[model samples]
Target: MFQQFSLTHVQFMLTGLGWTIGLAMIALIGGSIAGSAIALMRVSVNPVISRLAQFYIFVVQGTPLLVTLFIAYFGATYLGISVQPIVAIAVAFSFYAAAFLGDIWRGAIQSVPKGQREGAHALGLGRADTLIHIIVPQAVRIAIPPTVGFFVQLIKNTSLASVVGIVELTRTAQIVSNATFKPLEVYMTAAAFYFLVCFPLTLVSRGLEKRLKS
Candidate 1:
């Protein structure tokens, strides 16, 4: 018997949507912390540190995210280490997000005018002081649009957590579709939930870009 897609189903999916938000938050926070370090290392004066950071970014960017997730989730078990689904997801997403975010931030940092660094040097500002006080503030404006855009992409990418047995929004949609046998309705609702979450961020990104420009 086909079950009607009802309020109860919507509520169940809402619970899943909450988990989706939670996962995205985890990925973003972890990614940002690691990415900041990667960005700094990429711009390091030391050739060795910069090259190592470059290699890390290259490898992560070249590998597919799905493969990374599988390695994080299943590889742990193979190593006789037990881990929760969320833990593995967090690690994998952070690692994957760091590569791109690092590159995005590197470009932002480098985009600051060369004359600004020269001016800082003329004032006897140390490299660290110049970066912290002069360069970073300007780089932040350049970074915001692309960072927020990547965040929106990250939120949608959380759907991949389903492959690791995460009961996030997409997984809930799958369950609901199976039970009600209404994939179109169930999936359409899931897409709406994603749009509702992501669309606001898009508007915020644009607003910030305009405000920063002005």
Candidate 2:
């Protein structure tokens, strides 16, 4: 039975792991674009724009990823639109990631000196121009560590997508374990694979944090 842990299962699991990474990368890219827009809106002087951004962040952060997944799956159906599990998961996580990323970036933007903004104003830079030319570059430095750290969280969160029938790493482990009746070995391997993907990102984020401090 122990020998049932064959190379075939290993290859299958590796393929699933690749899907997990691919999904995560998609979420990161999509989330970053959406989240950046939300972050900027959050800091907008216009009350309505700021409120809208705040509301979006509030709803997303307040909901669990699982609940969000259900909404994405069934919600689309109710609206007469068919959605795939992968698309649903990607959409759910993009909004989910956006809320947190927006908040993190907002904090980073706020950390910049108020005097810097005034100085930019003195140089005749408009709000958009000032943010682009002055504030964003500085905020990027502060945001990198947390943003990278969040990638690990995002990767782990991909496991949640398995519930929706997405054939990512966790789902692959479940299928293999059910077949081989070796939950311990199969799941342990899955754990190792997750750690392999995430641990280096952890170290890299820490390194960036240390460098930022210096």
Candidate 3:
């Protein structure tokens, strides 16, 4: 039975792994942009803008990803919209990623000392100028560690995309286990693959955190 683990299965799973990585990259990049916007919005002095951003973060963070997936896929159909699973999963994960990242970045931005902002003001730097040249750069240094850590979570969350039939790594593992009748071996392999993708990131994030602290 062990000998029956064919190269074709390996090939298929490898392809699925690629898709998983691709989707994760998409989510990370798109989420980073959207999340930055939301983060800035959250910190804006405009009460309406801040509240809207807060509400968006609340709704996305409050709901489970599975429900988000269902809504992106099936709910859209109910609303007379056609959606592909990959597209639906990407959209859902992007929004989910944005919410968490927004919060993370907001914290980082806020962590800038009040005195620093006051100093910037004294230097004749207006709010926008201060944020761009002073606050954001410092915040970025503080943000790097957690941002990398969040990437690991983002990669893992891509597994949930499988429920929408996106044929990513988790879905491939399911297919392989169904075929090989070796849940243990297949899942173990999948776990190793996930670890391979994430462990280095974890180390890098930790290292950055330590260096920043120093």
Candidate 4:
């Protein structure tokens, strides 16, 4: 029997929305760690190291996000290790986000003018010092917009956690819709919630891009 969409249903969805945000934050922080390492290795002068990084990024980025999730969940089960939904989702999204973020940041770092490096070399700064004080700062400015834009996608991708039994936004909406028999209302509400979370990021990213350009 279909029940009415009640206030409680809305509240439940709100709780799930919180989970979605939390998952995205996890992905961001963890991915940033993994991504920095990947970016550094990708740009390493060592051909072997660079090739390895390239392979890692290619394999991970080429895989479907859902397949990553499945590996985090079911793959762990096959290995006889239990995995919680949040942990699995975090691990999956972290590696997934790392590939793209690393690629984005690598491009940003390389996009810096070669003259900047020449000037740093002329100043007697070591490679590490040049990167820390000069190259990184400039690359960071270039990277901010794309990084934030990727965050928007990360937030949306949290919906995939539903398949793993995480009560994130999409899963919560599905539950509510099933009970109330109101898929349209529940899904629209979910879409509104996602827009509320993501639209501000788009604005901020665009603003930063213009500021950087100027």
Instruction: Compose the digit string of candidate 4's lDDT tens values, residues 1-214.
Output: 9889988999999999999999999999999999999999888889999899899999998899999998888888899988776787799999999999999999999999999999999999999998889999999999999999999999999999999899999999999999999999999999999999999999999999999989
User: How many pairs of residues collide in model 3?
Assistant: 0
The TM-score of candidate 4 is 0.98
Candidate 2: where is the Cα deviation over 4 Å? 1-3
Model 1 agreement with the true structure over 1-214: per-residue lDDT tens digits: 8799999999999999999999888888888999999999999999999999999999999998999999999998999999897998899999998999999999999999999999999999999999999999999999998899999999899999998899999999999999999999999999999999999999999988899889
The lDDT per prediction is 0.94, 0.92, 0.90, 0.94
TM-score of 2: 0.96
Alpha carbon lDDT of residue 196, candidate 1?
A: 98
Assess every candidate by TM-score.
0.97, 0.96, 0.95, 0.98
Question: Tens digit of lDDT per residue, candidate 3, span 1-214?
Answer: 5435577887788888899889988888888999999999999999999999999999999999889888888877898888777787788888888999999999999999999999999999999999999999999999999999999998898898888789999999899988888888788888888999999999999999999999
Q: After superposition, how far is residue 196 of candidate 2 from its true place, in Å?
A: 0.6
Residue 171's lDDT in candidate 1: 97
Which of candidates 2 and 4 is the stronger one according to lDDT? 4
The better-scoring model by lDDT among 2 and 3 is: 2
